[model samples]
Target: MKKCPNCSADVEEVFELCWNCNYSFSEQKVIEIKDYTIQEGNREVNCLRCDIPLIFSGRYDFHEGARLGAWGNLFELFVNSERFDLYMCPKCGKVEFFIPLNDSEYKKS
Candidate 1:
């Protein structure tokens, strides 16, 4: 484990980037998450590689298939179990993940 120089946050050895401050170890930079929002009615996204429209898959929860045990329950407490909407390209099978602005906003009708 190493500490992020920028944020002094404890970073795991397996992870190259710091979760707290987004500090890159190799680049020696603090990368920030982009501020973007998905339009409520808009759905289609183009695939950069295949140039095909991305199809909306579904929401994924990290804790979905987690086993119920003492350590598993303890692990869940420290982890962020945010749901992300998955999009996939039908032709190339490339996947992309996006966080919805409102979790309970709309259905895919």
Candidate 2:
């Protein structure tokens, strides 16, 4: 359910942007939602000072669990079985990460 190329409103697929004019759909639709579960791989971390090549972005779960406590009435069933890959280094934000089954250079396309 994503249709807001720029004002065509009705966008809410965990929106990246576009709140009716804030369009930012650079086309990145890798959706496989049947209750949530997508895990791809490609890890080779290295960029803490200058070593490049850090890519491994895949692992998201939302199968009816994610409401956190405090007035929100906790509800974190099935939590996360370890799935995080979001590295960034836009020049200096230098960030590194690797957690794909224990980072043995994860490679599961």
Candidate 3:
């Protein structure tokens, strides 16, 4: 473990940025985290590493392409129609995709 030079918070050696204060050890400065994500749903989710609210990118649908290649046909069955919601952290630029919860769960006001 190592201590952040800016915030004096203990940070794992593997991580470059301090989790508590977004300080970059290599850059020797505090990382600016101005963008915060606001999801349409009321479901509040935070980044595991940065501990900041994640921005809801959008919803995406996956399906087989019109033209199948040699290996494409092999995995064709695996690439069925699927919908997923995408989320990303503005601070750390970390991304996460999840199967969306029930629509009723996000009754936007």
Highest lDDT against the true fold, candidate: 3
Summing lDDT over every window of 10 consecutive residues in candidate 3, give the lowest-scoring window.
Answer: 100-109
- Candidate 2 vs candidate 3: the TM-score winner is 3
Off by over 4 Å in 2: 1-51, 55-74, 78-82, 90-99, 103-109
Q: Which model is ahead, 1 or 3, in terms of lDDT?
A: 3
Tens digits of per-residue lDDT, candidate 3, 1-109, equal 9999888999999999999999988899998976444344444679999999998888876675553577776766565466668889999999888866664443222
Candidate 2: lDDT over CA atoms?
0.55
Sequence-dependent TM-score of model 3: 0.43
Worst 10 residues of 2 by lDDT: 29-38
Q: Supply candidate 3's per-residue lDDT for 18.
A: 98
What is the C-alpha local distance difference test score of each model? 0.76, 0.55, 0.76
**TM-score on alpha carbons, each prediction:** 0.47, 0.22, 0.43
Give the distance in Å from residue 79's predicted Cα in candidate 1 to where it truly belongs: 2.3
On lDDT, who's better, 1 or 2? 1
* Candidate 2 accuracy as TM-score: 0.22
Which residue pairs overlap in candidate 3's backbone? Answer: 37-55
lDDT tens readout by residue for model 2, 1-109: 7887556888889877766566667654333324223344544456677676655445543234456667334344334444456676655666654454554453332
Cα RMSD of predicted structure 1? 12.4
CA-only RMSD, every prediction? 12.4, 14.2, 12.3
lDDT of 1 by residue, 1-109 (tens): 8999999999989998999988899999988766455554246679989998888888776543464676886666655556678889899889988876666753332
